[model samples]
Target: MNRRDELAANLADVRGRIDRACAAAGRDSAEVTLLAVTKTFPAADVALLADLGLTEFAENRDQEAGAKVAEFAALRPGAAVRWHMVGSLQRNKARSVVGWADQVDSVDSERLADALARASGEHPLDVLIQVSVDGDPKRGGHPLPDLPRLADHVARKGELVLRGVMTVAPLGMSPQQAFDALHGAVTRLRDDHPDANVISAGMSGDLEDAISCGSTCVRVGTALLGSRRLASP
Candidate 1:
């Protein structure tokens, strides 16, 4: 099959898997929001998928994502997608992100949270604290040890709504380990912020484990888009 055809098949397969996973976990299919990680993928694929009834798209970079969002809004306004900023967001880029994205999945620090809050103003953007379930300092998320203080900071910010938490598994660590640590982190966050219950974990490969551990959302990419390519709109 050609690329578009392959993309359609991939989307179907991933959706089927998600449905089955939720069933196995004794959860409703709607409970897990599938965010197509369109990071390395280009705009045409995004347009195609959006036309195919997939309305949630995610990207890590500001430039590419901003371009794609603009393109989709102009060309495929009917899509009405919920864009997710799924990467490390710099403090300076907060305004741009808050302007376009419906939700940001990687608010890792109090400073970033404050910046997003200020930039959001009346917007009250939805945010998730990126916890380092991977235990990698080089990565963007806060360490699990610092979650409460950071969550407290997020709660105090009126412009940024603290909806939940997100995490990425370490490159070498097992998926179960990542899920366990992430779920534990969620429990910790809920101790004080009981409403902070969303766990943004899992991906194309480790989604089953993520759901088993109580993930409310799974960011799926290649399994839904074939491989990915980084290109401008």
Candidate 2:
């Protein structure tokens, strides 16, 4: 089969998974947005995914994402894909990220929030607070206790909107346990900012568990795009 056919099959399977997961959780399937993580994949794949009806895509690194974003736009000028930053980001890259990303899903600190706000133009950049369910610094996320403060900062900060929370279930712990904690964090954040409702949890591996715990968005990469290509440009 051709690459496009393979991607179409993968997309359908992933959507089926989301539907079944949501049904089991007693939630509406429409509540979950399937965010295609196009990291390390070529812009051509992004264009194919876009043609296949994926409106949301995410990247882990700014350097790679920046070029792919430009290429994808050139390839499909009218495609309405929402690019998202889903990896640990440095403060210095904030300026460049705002140039491409529609939302940053890994804002973990007040300093990062400030950088993004200052770099963003007149329009407010939507953001999700990254929660460290396991308090692992290497992975980059704010501890549960810090969510409220960071949410407030992002909400009140210039040109930045606190959309919600995002997290990766730390290895060695059950994904369910990690998502349970994240659900609690999201609940508390919502109490303060009701509009902050986007819970970007889960990935290709454990999306079912995340959906059970209230993930409104799932970032699927390998399952959708197959294996990563060796080179990215």
Candidate 3:
């Protein structure tokens, strides 16, 4: 099979897994969004995936993501593709990114929240508070004690729609443990922010665990587009 065919097959496999996971969780696959993480991959691959009907994509870097967005927007006008900012967002570049991204998946602090708010005035912005599942202070997410305050702050922004929570499961720990902790956090978040029900906790490796723990979205990369090849502008 060609690369495109292989990609189709791989996407199908992940879809099947997602279906099984949703069934096991007493949920339906249709309710969740499968974000094909096309990070470090070329715009060509992204274009191909778009042709394959994957409307949502996640990217971790601004430089790469910005370039891809420009290229795709140029190629496909009014194409219904949603871009997600799923990495550490730098404060200085907040304005530009907020303009392009449909959702900021890593709004971990009140400062970034304020920045995004100011940048997105009058523009609808979906935000997910990123939680570091491992309690790794060096990492980018906020501490458990600080989520509600941050959520409330983001909610105040007319442009920022606090949709839910997103987290990276702790590395070197059991996947189930990590997803369970995220699930607990999500449950608490949903209590206060009823619309904040999205749990973006799974990835290519531990997607099943994430699903079992009721993850509403799972970010998958290599499993979808094979290995990525970075392209230059």
Using TM-score, give the best candidate's number. Answer: 2
lDDT of 1: 0.86
Question: What is the Cα-based lDDT of residue 132 in candidate 1?
Answer: 89
lDDT of 3 by residue, 1-233 (tens): 88677778888899999998888889888877899998888777777788777999999988888988888887777789999999999788788897679999999988898888888867778999998777788876987667788888888878789988888877678989988987887788777789887888888988989888888899999889776687647
lDDT of 3 at 225: 79
Q: Report the alpha-carbon TM-score of model 1 versus the true structure.
A: 0.93
lDDT of 1 by residue, 1-233 (tens): 87678888888898898889889989998988888898877778888888778887899998888888888777776677899999998999999998789998899988899899889977789889999876688977898888889999999988878889999888888888988987887887787888887899999999998998899999998788766666764
lDDT of each: 0.86, 0.92, 0.85
Clashes of 2: 0
Alpha-carbon RMSD, each predicted model: 1.6, 0.9, 1.4
In candidate 3, list every pair of residues with a backbone clash. none
- After superposition, which runs of candidate 2 have C-alpha atoms over 4 Å from their true positions? none
Top candidate (lDDT): 2
Location of the lowest summed lDDT over 10 successive residues in candidate 1: 224-233
Write one digit per residue (lDDT tens) for candidate 2, span 72-153. 9899998877999999999999999999999999999999999999999898999998999888788779987778888888
